[model samples]
Target chain A: MTPNTTTADPLRKAASGIAGLDEITFGGLPAGRPTLIAGAAGCGKTLFALTFLVKGATAYDEPGVFMSFEERADDLIDNVSSLGYDLPGLIADKKLVIDYVRVERSEIEQSGEYDLEGLFVRLGHAIDKIGAKRVVLDTLEALFSGLGDGPVLRSELRRLFQWLKDRGVTAVITAERGPEGQLTRHGLEEYVSDCVIALDNRVDEQITTRRLRVMKYRGSAHGTNEYPFLIDKGGISVLPVTSAGLSHSISDEVVSSGVAGIDAMLGVGGFYRGSSVLLSGPSGTGKTTFGSHFVNAACLAGNRAIYFSFEESPEQIVRNMRSVGLNLDSHVTAGLLRFESSRPSLFGLEMHLVLMIRQIDQFDPAVVVIDPISAFRGSESEIHATLLRLVDYLKVKGITVVFNNLVNGDQDDRNEQSLSSLMDVWVGLHDLEANGERNRGLFVLKARGMSHSNQIREYRLGSDGVTLIEPYIGPHGVLTGSARIVQEAQEEAATLERRDEVNRRKREFTEKKSAAERQIAETREALQREEAELLALETVDERKEQILTASRSAAATRRGATA
Target chain B: MTSPTTPDPMGEDGAEISDDGIFHFRLYVAGQTPKSLAAIRNLTLLCDAHLPGRHKIEVLDLAENPELAAQDQIIAIPTLVRSLPPPLKRMIGTLSDPDKFLIGLDYSRPTS
Candidate 1:
């Protein structure tokens, strides 16, 4: 093979720490191919690339080399250490090489020909020394500014990419997000690389959001949607929106929600074990009350329970439930119940799922309660798919999860219905206003395997906790919720009772007539038996008289008569 | 005819090449009775070696993966598919002619 004419040998690929990401990019980064990750500052460009390298070394056992042009190695390590990534440890183990190449353009001897040969040498040495299969040149924007003119820098960059590719090491070259309509400072890196990923951070309606897009991946299909990510304690976790295959094993054991009537209405007296139950209602409709009851039941059954509160803090929840008569503090202290309280805005919805799954793994709870799933509605609709995955993850762990949804107004929340299909049971709490007061009504909207009473039960939140009353049923229908409905039902029931009393009197009259008929039949049988006895006695008398007459006619006949 | 144990010729493409450099390939075939597996392997080997490196030889034994025989496309073992390098090509059974394989890969037929 002639020099510079060697056949294009296949490049070694880099592995994405993300599961679906690797699958999308066949066999990882086109081994030694220069992939561009361009995004604005604070747009997670550095985080994404670092996670890629860190996950490669830690998770995939592929050593990596990180050549940072912007931040110092210590700062990078400190920033990411909270995300459960031990960057310092990886460096200590010599599995990762972090090279901070600070370029001072002012101090450079610009008079001489500028070449990246030194950088190439250093990068090569680091990669070869560490046996690295992956390389990340973070914030290549610094290089553009460091090298005065664009022409030399562009050519050098081109050569660098080629050099990396020829060596067959996967490389991630990050560039800063530029002005509108431009990807980076030079805008040429996007065209040079075989794969391009664009990250973005924006505040929509005062809500901060982060999203990532695989702008291009040559020869491979990638998820094209704007995947929302979170800068959380675990670095960055992409929500692989796609389902993990539709083979969720169904369960036959119906699990109870601890409410007898609710379980009864659910058809099988409970939901299927490991199934999800959605408690949907408007504010103050007792979503928490129902969820708390369930958690209490799970804990009482010797199962650990985890309550994720998005609205109320753990302390506030504990205090508030005191009026409902639930002592969550004891459970928490005992470690049977874990209260994970965070604002809905604490992290992206996927992060919520990840963190919840993490907490679940840590606590290994048998029951998980989300006080109100609606708290997550602030996230993009794309999160719905991720939420489904989270639900499945919980179910697969045999954890009975309860999502308390606050159904706003009378919009006939579709979220409840959509989630109900995945859930084993759904309880709807309605707040009805009647008789100058608001009363809560609890109804089992749907329960898959259990037989639950269809009647809406009236309930009240009081010092002792929630009181569920079997509402009166009358001629009109079964009453639920407020006192007025109950009173009207009671009045109708009174009318029905009056009507039943009259009917019962009429039945008694007919029964008396039947008794009199039976007495007459007995008297007739007595008369017949007396008549037969009298006939027999008269026949005997006739025989005796004949014998007496015979005796008088003939004394000797008496002996004959006796004989 | 060469002995059945003879190794397939390797082409010059750094891949094992055969007599036909155009269809440079090698298929290590052990036995006969082309089932589905045989058909796929044969076709792939043919394509990897013969069709612009598109034709590759794939050998399949009838004893393993027994269900391969049911396919209508493949009637025998060791099928080959020469997909690339233009005029796509295919061959069945133990591919016999190196000249034919090269021709399939768009190589000029060697004057014998």
Candidate 2:
């Protein structure tokens, strides 16, 4: 039955304290209510219940009582010790109480009518002993095997749930999953109508992945998707991708693409901070080289970085990056860079996502590089879903992420296309075959929020680093490699011949002009000499004639001179 | 209740005799409920009929000491446990059926 709270007033939730679980449930399980966790054997139902109690005790200051019907108190404590749960310590501190109710069908004979009041007494006593706010009845269905009165047991089980609610303790009741399509073996889901969570441990392609789903939350708007959860040394972590909605704050800052040439292509000088970049290319197209460059740049900036190499080991990556002038080993030594390498086939897509998230959380890196993410073997949709979550998570944390995907020729473009939608930047690498040579080409297919170059530049990976050479674009289309070299050479020779022809024409014109000038000078000089000689001869004749006249006209000459 | 010094009717059977040849029965109940009273009455009658002057009955009401319920691993109320015998035996519910109750108590009939 639903509580008497007003519909407009939201249901109060008790924080489960499980990582990402609160976010998925929008808060947590309903407070002061029982949540049935049903799962098959080895699916981690007991562990989940224990985590709820332990987390409540340690984190929320909520004392808890664990009434296990299937395992003894000591055995339960021993079982959870591997998970680093200090059950004994909690018990000793008066923060928790564990009561193992052992019920054996052959140990007692039924004579008349009896109820499970003793169970209530034991549970009640333990709860009161610690003032526990949380209670866990692990696999309460064990009663079905230990008792035979079906109707009486069912009624008492119903009363037990009601009693738990009346006591106002947030309870977690774990049950065995029933046969096909049923939520629990005894249909306990019908009793605990507040919240129901189902855990599944499935093996796909030789890899086992554990998943948790909120099947029903009566009064809460919870994430209904099956979230992948991981059980590691740190306990269970659920990867609730949908929890990190598109509401995360964005950053206007930019981080370099690791390679200057790539940064040059991105008009903003780098990718946006907290943005996702998809780097896709065929095999041997230097995808890892680009990723390494980004990581190297991040580490160089004194920012922590994690490189998830799905195809190469850390040592191998360091060695290979050395050839590209990226010294990742030093960064690793400085504790600024970390490498997590594992085969894509080693885990399911969700498991890989959880592992990556865990590593990222632990490292708290400013940048993350999943080199050759296309190495992941799964359905296209599944891979897309996994990447979407990963990108969402990284973006929410404001951590720059680069995904290097290996695209096999043209057909693999479909996979990249589906994932590219989630990326803030997409750099496509390809091998251009020309003039009997294959040259690497890099181009920015898309870069959101910044104007990026669309031109495909010739990418060269030398010992120094990656350089983006401007591809020669002529009438015959973009040319790279030897073809570009040959085209450049031919253009240089034509320029040289044109320069020589212009020089020869200029020399001939100068010679002709100088010869014409010399001829004109000589003619002018001869003409001047002839005029002078003629004037002198005339002067001599005039002087001889004037000498005779001069004697006679001396007197007249004086008067003519005066005039 | 009779004292244990009195002779027992079927004491010759070695299986029914303990170190003191006295039957020790501890009845666990929640309170003075009808079932608890009936269980106590029925068990007392069965003891008197089968092993007169050779039995002792002790009643433990869980309502008075709820914490003691866990000591005997008691779930249902009106649980009768035979503690003094070599082999410990327990029977749940009110002892309505005498034959079944006797069998649960591991009591053997004497040969004529």
Best by DockQ: 2
- Give lDDT tens digits, candidate 1, residues B20-99: 44442322222343333443443354444434342344444433433333221222124343433323333433444444
Best-fitting candidate, scored by lDDT: 2
Off by over 4 Å in 1: A1-12, A16-27, A55-63, A81-96, A128-132, A188-192, A219-221, A322-336, A360-366, A377-399, A409-424, A448-452, A460-467, A480-563, B1-112
Interface RMSD of each: 28.0, 1.0
Using all chains and alpha carbons, the TM-scores for the candidates as numbered come to 0.66, 0.87
Each model's lDDT comes to 0.68, 0.87
The digit string of per-residue lDDT tens for model 1 on A41-117 reads 78888888888888889888879999888888899999888888898899888789888876555323222123454
Superposed by TM-score, candidate 1 places the C-alpha of residue A182 at a distance from the truth, in angstroms, of 3.6
lDDT of 1 at A526: 100
DockQ of 1: 0.01
